[model samples]
Target: EPEVTQTPSHQVTQMGQEVILRCVPISNHLYFYWYRQILGQKVEFLVSFYNNEISEKSEIFDDQFSVERPDGSNFTLKIRSTKLEDSAMYFCASTKTGNIGYTFGSGTRLTVV
Candidate 1:
């Protein structure tokens, strides 16, 4: 079966630096989403994109964060300014239907020092 893939499984950056997390979502899917898990915290939705525009984004998706579909299969998240609190496992997910369960990439671990 096809699966989502994320590059640089782990990333370490200094606070205030910019970071880009890359993900290649599953082909043939129409909806994509980004979520983050802060250590022991619950998975929080950052943003959902469809039809090349943002469908929904939580409060956490502030000016510091942005999502883009630079290519057919690639979805990327750019953090303009990293913070120590930004450390988390960022997961990329996709689904054929927005309401259905999603298939998530292993995740990219961001560690802002």
Candidate 2:
């Protein structure tokens, strides 16, 4: 079975630098989402994309963040400027429909130093 893939399982970046987390969603999946877990906090939704447009985005998805489908199978989330608070486990997920549970990647662990 196909699975979502994320790179650099752990990332340590400076507070002012930029970081791009990469993901390859499951093949044949049409909906993609990005979520984050701040250490012990609950999972929070960042953004969701479909049909080449953002379907929804939470307040956390500010100007510093952007997402793209760089190619047929790759999705990316770029943080233009990092902050200490931005450190978290960022997970990429995809599902064929909203009614079903999502399949999440192992997660990219971002650490702002």
Candidate 3:
């Protein structure tokens, strides 16, 4: 089965630093979404991307956060000025179509101090 792959399984950074989390969605998938889960909290949607554009975003995806597919392949989430509260496990998910089941990357655990 195809799977989404995220780099740097874990990361630790100082407050106010910048972080770029990378992800490669399933090759055949057409829709992609970024989500985050605080240590013990429920998953929270951040943004959705399709057709090389961001289709929707949650309030949590404020100016500090941005998503982009720089090339035809990988997707990336950049978090500027990271804060302690921003520490969480970021996941990348992809679906062949909106109706199909999603394949999610294990996630990148970010720790902000």
Candidate 4:
């Protein structure tokens, strides 16, 4: 079985600072996504990428947020300016198809102070 991998399992940053979360999806997968969950809240989708372009994005993915596949295998999320509200567990996921099954990375816990 394949899985998504995220780095720096945890991160602490000052408010207004920039942060980049990294992930590597299953090599064979075609769809990739970034999702976040504020502590005690439901998971929220941030953005979806396919074929080197954004396929969909949530309102949460505003001007401050961006996603990139700098290399064919590494998918990354950049937060231009962090906010206390942005402190959460960010997950990376991928699937061969947009079906119900998706492999999600353990998550990167970002804490904005």
Candidate 5:
């Protein structure tokens, strides 16, 4: 019955600007993740966090991207500089364990102009 929550459902930013997307996963979950889907493309994993550290990250999570649980409650993704290619729907997800299903947030639509 628990759920993940994402804020600012949509965001528009200028290219080269910075943006931070926020999410609060199910309180008791142990693993949290950030994924993104470029319009009409498959969803891609960006990073996975556990125990306050990054457990896994995809190639897409380059030097410009970072994730942190600044308050041990809200998980955030920061893009150092926005790019037109970065426009996509970002999703936050969490699960009690890897074998279990994940609860995903509605998604944050980021648009770079």
Candidate 6:
């Protein structure tokens, strides 16, 4: 089975720095998304994408965050300015349809210090 791939499995950046988390979801999937899990907290939805546009986003995905599917293959989440509270395990997920059979990337761990 194909898998969603994330780069730089772990990253540590100082507060205020910019960071871009990258992901490559299964090629045939139609929906892609991002979510984060703070060290001890449940997963928090960040954003969702479809047809080259942001289909939906949560409050946490504020001005400081952005997502793009550059080149139609690379899905990326950019944090314009890092904050201590932004530290978390960021996951990438995709599905052929929006409602079922989701496949998730291992995750990129962000550590904002």
* RMSD (Å) of each candidate, 1 decimal: 0.7, 0.9, 0.8, 0.7, 0.7, 0.6
Please, what are the lDDT tens digits per residue for candidate 3 over residues 14-54?
99999999999999899999999998899999999999989
Cα-based lDDT at residue 90, candidate 1:
98
| TM-score against truth, every candidate | 0.98, 0.97, 0.97, 0.97, 0.97, 0.98
Give the deviation of candidate 4 from the true structure as CA RMSD.
Answer: 0.7
Best by TM-score: 6
Better of 3 and 5 by lDDT: 5
By TM-score, the better pick of 2 and 4 is 4
- For candidate 5, list the clashing residue pairs, or say none: none
**Candidate 5's residue-wise lDDT over 9-74, tens digit each?**
999999999999999999999899999999999999999999999999999999999999999899
**Overall lDDT per candidate, in order of appearance:** 0.95, 0.94, 0.93, 0.96, 0.95, 0.96
Q: Model 6: residues >4 Å from true position, as ranges?
A: none
Off by over 4 Å in 2: none
Check candidate 6 and list the clashing pairs. Answer: none
In model 4, where is the ten-residue run with the lowest total lDDT?
A: 94-103
Candidate 4 TM-score over all chains jointly: 0.97
**Candidate 6 residue-wise lDDT, 3-91, digit = tens:** 99998899999999999999999999989999999999999999999999999999999999999999878899999999999999999
46: Cα error in model 2, Å: 0.4
As a whole number from 0 to 100, the lDDT of residue 66 in candidate 5 is 94
Over the full model, what C-alpha lDDT does candidate 4 score relative to the true structure? 0.96
The TM-score, computed over Cα atoms with residue i paired to residue i, of candidate 5 is: 0.97
For candidate 1, the 10 contiguous residues with the lowest summed lDDT are 93-102
Ranked by TM-score, the better of candidates 1 and 6 is 6
